[model samples]
Target: MLALRARRLFDGQEMRHDQVVIVKDGRIADVTADVATDVPAAVDLGDATLLPGLIDCHVHLAFDAGHDVVAMLEPPGLPDRMRQAARQHLAAGVTTVRDLGDRDYLALGLGLGLDGPEVLSAGPPITTPGGHCWFLGGEAAGEQGVRKAVRERAARGVHVIKMMVTGGEMTPGTHSHLLQYGLAELKAAADEAHAHGLPITGHVHCAQGIAHVLDAGFDSIEHCSFFTEDSYAVDHTVVAQLAAADVVVSLTVGVAPSPVPLPPRIQQRMAGMREALRAIQAAGVDFVIGTDAGIGPPKPHGVLPYGAEMLVENGYAPLDVLRAITSAAARVCRVGERKGRIAPGFDADLLAVAGDPLSDITALRRPLAVYRMGSRATGRVGQINQTAPTIG
Candidate 1:
């Protein structure tokens, strides 16, 4: 058994103080203010705030975060590169990630053991012929074809289904504002995935695509950017619809500070993107952050901390951002029972930072220590400003 006492704790929901978390057999045994004196080992983290390890709802481990990830995806060394990416997230205190797209189902076979985050994978996203991300090899047409595609992914044991309901910016011939799959095909994919006991999410951009996917009963929507042919637009009606629907929107956010500016197309739409985010927040839509990590130079595998900061900077409540990255993200990813909370019977996946994130959201960037399944994956207690001494 091991005990860790911290100055404060965010139990995946709210903040508390003077808490001690006890771990045994790779799970949290208890989280209480009463620290048992009989515990064989104890570690005191001074001037630190403990939080449940973060979860990134969307990432593409197959694409290395570079200027041209599609061109750089060489098959021979892809798996090794993916492993390194997963470790990057782990080291940054992200203990869970849902790989929404990958080449040849590689994310499911990473076999990273205790050193990496728990990976939930969608092997290859289902898309229409010549549609967005067709290069990843999931292509289908019509309702029947989409149903079959979902079945195949389910057979491969994918944790969720990712279907392209619209084109994407990454593909040259595609248009992010255009719908790729019709309502029939989208509904067929969602139904088939649900039949197999898997949740289905759609890659959508335009308001029409978002409405279609929501009508088809999709569990979630990704990149709800509401783009038009040339510039971007956020339809307030659709935003209201999203707020009233049962679906969750995985907002694409976060950009690490890098010398490379955002792509010209994205850079031009920055104001509209911010408007969409603000509208979503004002409408009180359910949301979680999906960094779209590994798709560009500004987005790296471990960039979730930046995402939390981005939301807070954009008029979002810091506490809400905290929940979005932790408990709310876990619920959307279907790991709510075990992965997100810092409570008893939960996996001992925890992050300790040097300061209170609620007060200074940037404190997330200063990770004092990370514990995955009770094993120290990165950081050290002594690294904090205050010296922490081990006790036994």
Candidate 2:
């Protein structure tokens, strides 16, 4: 067993000072304040805060985060690009990512290993023929068609089912305000997915679409932006309903510092989007951030830390934000049993930053060390000899 000592530890739920986490056979053996005498040695990380590695609930490894993401999909070496994207997330201390959309199920081939974060993919998101993301090839019409689509993805071993309930900004003919699938079709897809023991989430923008998904029994909603034809508005009633129903919202947030300007339409909606998010938080709706990384230049692969910072800036408590990205996200992704917590029997996927993130959320960007399943993936953690004294 390997003992990793850090000045502070956020064991998924809450913070504890001066803790030692023990790892054995790629899982956490124990986490205690007192170091055992028989333990071989402790890798003491000075002035660092240890946390369960962040999990991005929504991502698209197939997109290259370029000027023309759809065009980039047509090129060769797409799988290699996807792998590189996964590595960027891992290097940024995100140990798990759920690819909400990808082309040709490429995200599934990214094996769970130290090379990259553990990827839980939804293959190609189900959409209407010629609807949003139709280029990704997940197109079905009618209730029977939607059910067949869900069954196909489930048979392929996808962890979740993603359906386009509304149009998206990325697709030219599709409008974010318009619903893509009818209520009957949405219900069919949700029923088929749950019947196969998989959670189904919907890509929703307008308030109407959000309500439609909730009524259809979707487990979660993505990009709950509340977009209208000309602008966006947050419907408080729907927000209240979401909180009451206990539906998780995967808020699409995070924009990395970049010289390139945002797209004209998105640039105009920034202020409105912020206000909508504020309303969601105010209504006590459960939320986790999904950077929508790899969708544009501002959304590069490792933008989750920036997302945490954005939440803190917008009145979210650091402690709550931290849980949303770790334990809460794992539970939403249906991997809480193994991936999120820093307790005994959990995967030893830990991240140690240079300072306390609770006090300063930006500290997350300064990763001092990252461990993936008991193996050091990046950074140099300080190691002391067994004879030398170790920190708690």
Candidate 3:
């Protein structure tokens, strides 16, 4: 058994000071304020706070963050690039990531071993014929086609089903504000995924697409931006319906400052995007952050901290942000039992930062150390500040 003492602990829900977490055989054995003398050894993490390893609900390890990811999809050394990206996420303290889109089921074959984050893959997202991301090779035209697509993914061992209910800006011929599949096709996809005991998530935008997603009974919605033909709008009525239905909204969050210029359309509509996000928060909808990592330069695989920090900066409670990334995110990913909390009977995956995050949210940016499977894994990339070594 290994005992780790920390100044404070955020056990995925509440904060407690002067705690010791015990690990045995790669699982949390116990957590207590009083350290037991029976523990053979202890590692004292001075002046640091321990937190559950973070989970980013949406990522695409196959898409290296760059100016033109679509063009680079099938480039040389693609497998090597994916392995590197997964490790980058691990080094940033994200121990689990749900890959919402990938080509040829490459993420499942990465073979990064224990050092990489736990990957829950979607293989390839279900899209309409020649619709958004159809280039990824998941184009289904009719209701039967959508059902077949979901069954194929289930057979491929995908953890969840991802469907594009609307077009996306990333694809040249597709419009983000327009529906890609009608209600019947969507319902077929959802019913098929449910029959196989899987959750279905829809990529939707605009009020009409959101309503269609609800009508089809999808378990979760992604990128609920409420976009229109030429502008953006926050549909409070649809938002209320979503909240009333108790559906989870996986908000695509996070961006890094880059010298490379953003696309003109996105750059112009950023203000409106922020406004919609604020309104969504006010509606009190269930939410979890999905960094949509690896899509471009602004969304590198390690960008989850920036997303959490962004939410806290925008009038969100730090505790809520913490829960969103930890326990809440794990729940949405269907790994709630083993992945999120720092409690006994849970996986021994934890992150230690140099200071209390409740006071300054940026503390998460400075990970002093990371533990995975009861082992001291390395995470030496994030920003850090030194402090006197002391223990209570």
- Expressed as tens digits, the lDDT of each residue in 162-223 for candidate 3 is 99999998998999989999899999999999999999999997789999989998988998
Q: Write the per-residue lDDT of candidate 2 for residues 109-200, one digit (tens) a residue.
A: 87647888999999999998899999998999999999999999998999999999999999989999999998999999999999999999
Ranking by lDDT: 1, 2, 3
Q: What is residue 145's positional error in candidate 3, in angstroms?
A: 0.1
Which candidate gets the maximum lDDT versus the true structure? 1
Over the full model, what C-alpha lDDT does candidate 2 score relative to the true structure? 0.89
Summarize candidate 1's per-residue lDDT along 79-196 as a digit string, tens digits: 9989988888887888999999998999999999787899999999999899899989999999999999999999999999999888998998999999998998888898999999
- TM-scores vs. true structure, each candidate: 0.96, 0.95, 0.95
Pairs in clash, predicted candidate 2 = none
Off by over 4 Å in 1: 378-392
Select the stronger candidate by lDDT from 2 and 3: 2
Reference-based lDDT, each prediction? 0.89, 0.89, 0.86
